[model samples]
Target: MTAVTAPEPAEQAKEGEGSLRSSAMRGGIYLVVRQGLNVFLKLIGVMLITRVLGPTEYGAYVAAFNVYLYSTLIGQAGVGVYLLRHPGEVPDLAVRTCYALLALLGIGLMLGLEASRGLLTGWTGVPGYGPVMAVMALALPFKLITIPPTIALERALNYKRVATIEIGGDTAYYFVAVPLALTGTGAMSLAVSLVLRELLFFVLAHYYVGHGPRFGFDGRTAKSVIRYAGTFSFANWVWQARMLVNPLIVGPVAGQHAVGIVGMTVGILEMLSIIKTIAWRLSVSVLGRVQSDFEKIRRAVTEGMELQIIAVGSLLLGFAWFGGIAVPLVFGARWAPVMQLYPYVALAYLAIAAFNIHSAVMSVIDRNTDLGLCYVVHILLLGLGTWLGVRHFGMIGYGFGEMLALLAYGLVHWALARRIGSPDYRLAGLWFVAAALGLFWRQLGWWTIPLPFLALATPASVRRIRRILEQIRKPRRAEARA
Candidate 1:
């Protein structure tokens, strides 16, 4: 074996960053796997608990958990947005201070939850959820407090550590509490699990952050961090509030069981999000690396868009193909409601991917103002759309409404796609499913015949795949001298 010298200090630092990037990529995969595994197990747990506790009880738990999720989003303070927007100039002290503000916000949220549990009980009519909601509400702090540290890890791109902690914690939660849940923890099992999960992250986040539990905050630094993070916090609150309105609307209008159905459908949607995140993980991070070089950024963005299209198209096509068995096996028969919504949700994800490159370019160029404005509008429209859809269309209608909102957003994304950089129009096949569904949705519900129909739905990727096969099969077809 040849003698190998260690890298010099500067070279080692470069190597460290290179390794970190690779780690981030692997961590994205691991995180996706972990989420997939947890969702898979939770599906088992949901099936067991649904069968055990019955619909009303499971609905109560899912409802309370939606509340918990919305609350957790409030405390992010958009630290990730802020950090991602300005990675080069974000000081550690500022990050610490932002963490401080979020901590305070989290504590206040917990207190507010405790103070309002009686109101929630009255509003929800799930008196059993009173104490459980109180406990689950406190989980907001545990979850939110971890964000700063987690964001730091994300910025550093040393995501394996964070991903490991998350996976380990989730695995612990599944193995430990799922049994109690099956034995008959009811709605409380979910609340208890939420607390346990958040607390685990709290401990792990602190360990990763190298920050001891301390309350000493700097007023000056806090003011600065607040000034920067305040805008993010507002955007976050708006987005979270937008998300919360769905459960608030559907639960009251359609009842807890209906909300459970909707949540179950969305749970399937969550799997798509995991796919989207993993596919875009490197694309998003690479935005940071290509900030100033417009020419280089444009080229990188082009390659990234191609990758996003191919990847998301393939995934969505696969999902649309296999979702019939996958949906029922994973989420249980009670959530059979999801069977109706899964394909449309896949279409929505496809629409999102259609503009993934534009999204990256917009962020790389620091177009948050425009992006935020558009999202704010989208959120407002979605809120109205969800309400009308829930009231008029019921479950399937809600899916229709979501698709419409996605359609509206997709157009905006398409228009902006040009502004960022023009992309191939062929990707629009992913977005026009709504147009197709409007034409054919009434004719076909869950077209599981596996005959000629489902193949017709995912035409965008099919065309691309056909082209690729042709290219592969006929590499010399283009090279023949005329």
Candidate 2:
């Protein structure tokens, strides 16, 4: 479970040339497809739930689910990140030991959550949330059990298999939740589906991995994983804390109906975040494969960021232009409040995309402490901002508060990257331009039709895009040869 030092730069480049290209192309396609299917299934769930329950009820369910999400994060204890970041060959004992620890954490998390039932109910302003959270807590141990196999598959770049398992779990969510909702389970449908989803994933992952858990401990391996986990898990907790700003802070202050609006907006915003998620995952995988080769990490980080900027920017732009019209049409008039709040939510995604590569680079270089420190600051700033926003400005203020936090988050990375002399000014500049164009398109409406033509008209922009296309095509060519 310890890190292995990479070969020298020249040797790395020689070995990496074709490997990186194929990995990027094949892995990128499968991951994108995986995310695409995930989003589609998620939309189906959302559509069913929204149609079945009114916003207030849906918000109540979301609040309970949020508590479950937070619990899962604590239960996970960064085991997945720890496994993914391991530089050496992962031993079976290491995996088993991690599972043992995760299972214990899961049980502890469930108990802690159950004990806090009164606080959770008060925070979400829904007494039903207490029992709903209790139901959702049942899934944690199953979720924890799946992590070892899941991370093993991902680290080996078996994303297609991993994606299959994930999609299968999501498919189960729809099948289980929708029928229950029709039967008038109310918020219970969501909680039940959440547990079923994890159980399915656990069974599928172990089946594919051809392994079962072993109850053994390896002290050395435990120390190694725990050493990394300490920082990574704390950062994740802070992140979950940041996530709770809406449900924990804003929900009680603004009321359940307001929480419903915020929940739907955040959900839609997360769907849009798939693009950034894909980019971040692929970059980490790519960097992890090369280990410590700084130059290749730089190239991968740069090319990856540029491509993400274009794709994420364009997607956000489309959402900003079309969401106002589409939200009402798709989710029904009941969800109209999402449209007004979504544009700002989209900005947070944009800022995340802007600085995501910095995170990959940080991981590659072992700057996790720095990254953790940034997360700490982000939580403090965002927590205060969200409270003020919801208390005074209402639902839209939640988006504004997050937007402000993400801006600060991006700035921390920018300054860090600058100090390391790794900031990509040109790519970073494009993010702002893209954001402005998206905002303008939303503001000016149809008049921005010619904007795409004008932006891509630049020779440099066109060439960069062409290079990205070539990078995408290289893996297909490699596959054809095989």
Candidate 3:
């Protein structure tokens, strides 16, 4: 009998790395498809709900929803991130500990919101604000419980299952919310739909994982998780504070109608920047595995920046060119203010796309302190800029604040570049300048119409496009050979 030979460690490592890359690539594709579907689902739902609710009622919903979103940062506590980025297999004890912590935090946040419900209602001065918040708060525990199972799937790079759960939940939300809104349920339509979405997600997450995490606690595991989670949560909390600015500052300064207008502008921007969201989610899992390799991480950041700009820049510019007609036609004249706000907000999201990978890298490398400081600078600038601009310029002042906050990305870039040598931003920068100019075509006139095309015609841009085409084709060629 012939002797069988085992693979050497070097060969084994190479094979393992290849497997990981394949999984990550497939996972990324799944996420892109998922986000694409979500964007369609959410856009339709927003249009239907906004048309029914109008500015005043929708503004009230936005205010309460913003509070709920911000509060979730605390409830999450970043334990899921700790699980996702852990170097190797996480112990069952640690996973159970994370579950216990998340559940407790969720309950704590719920009770805290309930206790302060009256104050929040009085402060917002919007009808049905208190009840809406109460309903949204009830979803907190279910939302938190889904985290461990979701992280389990993410850790395994099984984004197809994750995508399925997310898409299903989102579909269920609009299915329920739109009918209720058409029936004149007002803001509460969204509140009820949100609860339903979380419940569905919670059940589906556990079911897909085969079993839910058994509740348990270990002192050492809890402490280690908290140590990492605390720093991570602090950075995230400060970052998420941006969500509160509209409700706390814009709502007070410009009133509910203006709040609705700004909220709608942001909501639309969020839909268009779905690529950024997918990239961030993919980075957290993919980069975490290669945290020890500075070169790999640096290359990933450079490629990610170029690809994101190419993907998102076109969408922003297209919206800028055509949104004026579409918004008024579809959502009614009440949403016309969204056009004026779109350019400024679009610019911010574009800048973020250019450097978002840096934030993900920082998290992978356990540089949460630096991340927290960057967030602090950003939130402070954003808060100050919005406050001064809103007070002075009225509704448009919020746009100015968004413009001013662009400087914060500079801080993030510097922090990350300091850690891992700077990424190649040439293509991203070119696309960014062209997209920025194109966004103000109303002000710049026909001259700006051809700029994005001009940017794409550059040799660097052409080379990048060819490389992307090759990458896409290579997969099909390999599949054919197989």
7-73: candidate 3 lDDT, tens digit per residue: 3446437757655556677888898889889998987998899988998899989998999988887
Off by over 4 Å in 1: 1-24, 84-92, 121-129, 209-211, 214-216, 279-282, 295-331, 356-361, 414-419, 428-482
TM-score of 1: 0.79
* Candidate achieving higher TM-score, 1 or 2: 2
Candidate 1 lDDT score relative to the true structure:
0.61
Top model number, lDDT: 3
Candidates ranked by TM-score, best first?
A: 3, 2, 1
**Tens digit of per-residue lDDT, candidate 2, span 1-482:** 22212234465467566866576567677888989999998888888778778688888787877777877888887778777776556677777788889888888888888889888787667657887888888888888888888877777678899889989999999988999988898888888998999999999888877767665688998887778777777766776675677678877788878777888887887787687777777777666666556666666667766766677777777777777788777778888888777777777777677677777677656667677778777777777778888778888788768766875665555645554556455744654565555555655576664565467657777887898888777877877897
lDDT for model 3, please. Answer: 0.85
Per-residue alpha-carbon lDDT of candidate 1 for residues 1-482, written as tens digits (9 for 90 to 100): 01111223464357554443454456566766666776676666666665566556766776677777777676665655665555354555555566677788888888887887777766755546576787688688767767666666665556677677787777666665667777777778777777887788888877876774444466876765566555545544554465465457666666777666666666555655565565555556655564665666565554445455455555555555566677657545555566666666556556666555565566556554555666676676666777788789786656665666664565455545555554445434433443334323324654433322343347755675576566444424433431
* lDDT, ranked from best to worst: 3, 2, 1
Winner by lDDT between candidate 3 and candidate 1: 3
Q: Which stretches of candidate 2 lie over 4 Å from their true place?
A: 1-15, 418-420, 440-453
Worst 10 residues of 1 by lDDT: 1-10
